[model samples]
Target: MAAAAHQADRPATGGQGCRAMTGGDRDGAPGDFRLTRRQLCALPGSAALLGLLGGCAFAARADAPPLPSDLFGGTTADPYLLALRAYIWGYPLVRAAQVRQNTTLPADPFRPRPPSAAGAAINRLGHAAELATPLMKQGVAPNNDTLYSLAWLDMREGPFVLEMPDFGDRYYTVQFGQADSSTEQALGQRTHGGQLPPVLIQGPDQQVALPAGMVGVRSRQRYMMIAERSLVRTPADLPAVHALQRAMRLRRWVDYAAGTDLPAPVSDQRPLLAPDTRCPAPLHFLEMLGNVLRDWRPDAGEARLISGLRPLGLAAGRGFRLEALSQAGRAAAARGLADAEAAVRAKTFTLGRNVNGWSVNYGGSVFGEDHLLRAAVAMDQIYVLPAEEALYPNARSDGGGQPLDGRNRYVLRFGAGDLPPVDAFWSITMYFARGLMVPNAAGIYSIGDRTGGLVRNADGGIDIMIQQEPPAAPRSVNWLPAPPEPFMVMMRLYRPRAPVRSGHWKPPAIQKIGGA
Candidate 1:
């Protein structure tokens, strides 16, 4: 019962048999589905919960679904429920690990990694020389407005020094995330303003002397993911952003203290996972979670929750073990994981308020104990900034509620003075399913207030054309080309205004045009 939220307006039955609004799958994983907070709360009882999970796993089988309760004590929950909760609790940590592993692994010749992948080994910084194109596949919901620089760090080694260049009023942020997928620190224009400072980053147990003019920041975990984003105003601005990215530096305490001439060699650590690998079996997935958890010590609250999972072959310090689980036990665990995967994908549609066919996703990386929401966010779009820093309002359908298809022409019209209100900037990016960029002959992936050659009406209203073929004449100047298939669009507002965040100011609905 602690897993579900109490909502006065939502039915207690969890909207069973309703036409669920679905979100995109993760990493193109087959048969993966997402869930939302409302849907999660709608789960009626244990029977209902078990039915949703076990139903997906055993739909085609004639035999009765596996009995998860058989594996546990009389008072404890069924293994299916325990494993489902565990999956929700550990999704972020495990997904983050997958991304970290893929980022650092050497790109195999046979496998074409996402063009935008960091591709840098551990402790090495990899900068994207240009903004993301259609071919980029590094992260979910990739934004074309900013170029990225990424790194994976083992903070147990020592304190690391991070330096930021003078970004004179440009919007930028360097997000440091812990292994458990919580935000450690985010430094940039919003928090630090124009005058940026050098930082000393270290783990909780790490302590080192900071040099003069350096600030110390400590993380709760030893494994860290450093993702830095710099705004790219236009195609020509790549060089300028690249320069700032190059100026940024991360070095071990020893290297910085000794004034080492050469950068420290990347640690000789090999990634245990391969790029674009199939999602592991449920047992294998839990084993991976166990291995990651062994390196991480949970806090008091986490320890309490994790303690309950011991009966399901999972403990905080000890990794997941298969030696004792019976064949039935394994099957139950597998069903539990499969159910969670489906629930996550099925519930992603309601992460935040939806107005005029657009979903304003909230929560970002600061999910405090709302594990289902966290897993849904991780599944749909990982590593989003907190709502205060940025708001991503996206849509996969038209105002009429039909799924957006490239076969039909559409227009996104902003009435005079109805542009998205934000302190920094805004952009509407075109994406295929799973947030991949839409490939087009025009090489256009996004358009916004900052987009050059944008033509507006005499009343100052802007009309953005969305279709497969280019529009004729002046309208073509505002065209955002889409693939000749189903697609989605996301509007990114950096430093969004209170009106947008509060849902008082809604984005204009996208209108389908008559016969193309």
Candidate 2:
């Protein structure tokens, strides 16, 4: 759909099933267990559209007319078809918008700095440890184990080279993605095994150098991102981590080869990508989808979904124009988007396996073929790493299956040495629905082994206080603050050990401290 020419042979269906490539190949399997996309489209009216959203949300309409030979494809498409098609297409696009919107901030790095200055940010280099800012709002999921180093690539300027540091014995990762936020590739301690390698990324039209010792290479979309995570153990570890961060550089291919000096930081901020969270609104979401379709590379099998979406002016370059649709068509399109949002919301909450109030997921973060699941997870938690890298055991309730809110006090105690089994480090971070990080007095957003002054219970066990108000002094030492409103907790186990990965080391339930 984009101007960038992608390999026409990139595998249409990811061998992965509904989740990531973790599952297996799902060939011409029924759209949702049905015979074909046509069968899925045969449902009766608008309700059918809602019901079959996950199955073949973007599959071409059952008896829909042919795609236009050009952009002005006239449509007799009813509201229901528009709704389903728009919703399915908008799902992933909204994530792209959300990631673009939140990470676009000036303070968080990923700002409009030129490629040469990418490695030298505000004097801090390509990565930062996030020492002081109590990050209250962020688009992507936050991990306390590792401080962040972010890079947003505008590949239109030509290909760039990412210099990877040999972070030996440390947990670090560079997650690569397109504007649509699909995790295209990974580089780090996990993938490359502590190798310091110069990586080459080829842009659509650029003459770039292939550096020596540049161990890995790949091609990506015009607008891309590389989110790097550098593990930081404590305040004492900050300086050393910063040193590692300073050494990592992102230079344009030509500059590195010629040792060309980088330009000074450029001017002013960009416009908003998406205003609201969850990207709940329909029209704006569809517009973002139209924008993505104009540039995102579609796989071979994705043609069917695109065929369905094209009629709505959401094709590669057509762009979704609400005015282009008739009054009834516009209304139907809105209704369809609304339904799709509702369905996506439902699926994300209930999709994973429920265990002790935690929706413990091993996969589904890295989307491949299952666009429905991809959209659902992007809504639930964007930029989540695949299980092997790290796993987020997310929870919104306590052990008794009661909803978690700061109105009540709670104690999550770990039996001696039972604190999340992991090789690198583990942390429990609290976040509210609207805000990404819970606002607390201590300027402390997360608690873990690295957190200072954590007190242990009598027998080497630990009690983590979870409540709005402060507990008495001694007990408060282990306090991980919570929002006064409904809150959720995330337990991230970096470089998880076999027990945790094998499901043998289940986390202790967040036991409510008092009935009151």
Best by lDDT: 1
The alpha-carbon RMSD values of the candidates against the true structure, listed in the order shown, are: 9.1, 11.8
1-516 in candidate 2: lDDT tens per residue?
000000011001111111111001111111122224564344323232323233432233222122223321234456556556556445665455434433444445545533212222321224444542334122223445566676656665546677766788877877765555456566788767877577776765555556566754454555666677777887688787788887777777667667874632422323223333232233555666666666656666555566666556566655565556666666666656645654554455543666677777666355655555665565555556656667777777789887676778999889898888876678887765322456677776778877777888889999999988778998777888876655677788776887877788888888887654
Pairs that collide in candidate 2 are: 83-336
Instruction: Please write out the lDDT profile of model 1 over residues 1-516, one tens digit for every residue.
Output: 000000001001012231111223221112222233343334323242333333233222222223243322233546767777777778777766666666676443224334454446667677767667756533446677787777778776657887789999788977777776666467788888865688888887876766688777787875787788788887788788878987888888888878873554555433322243332344555766776777777888778777878777778667776654667777787677656655655556656666788876655567776777777676666667667777788887788877677778999999889999998899988876445577777888888878777788899999999988889987898999976656778888888889987788899999999543
Poorest 10 consecutive residues by lDDT, candidate 2 = 1-10
List TM-score per model, in order. 0.81, 0.73
Tell me how candidate 1 scores on lDDT.
Answer: 0.66
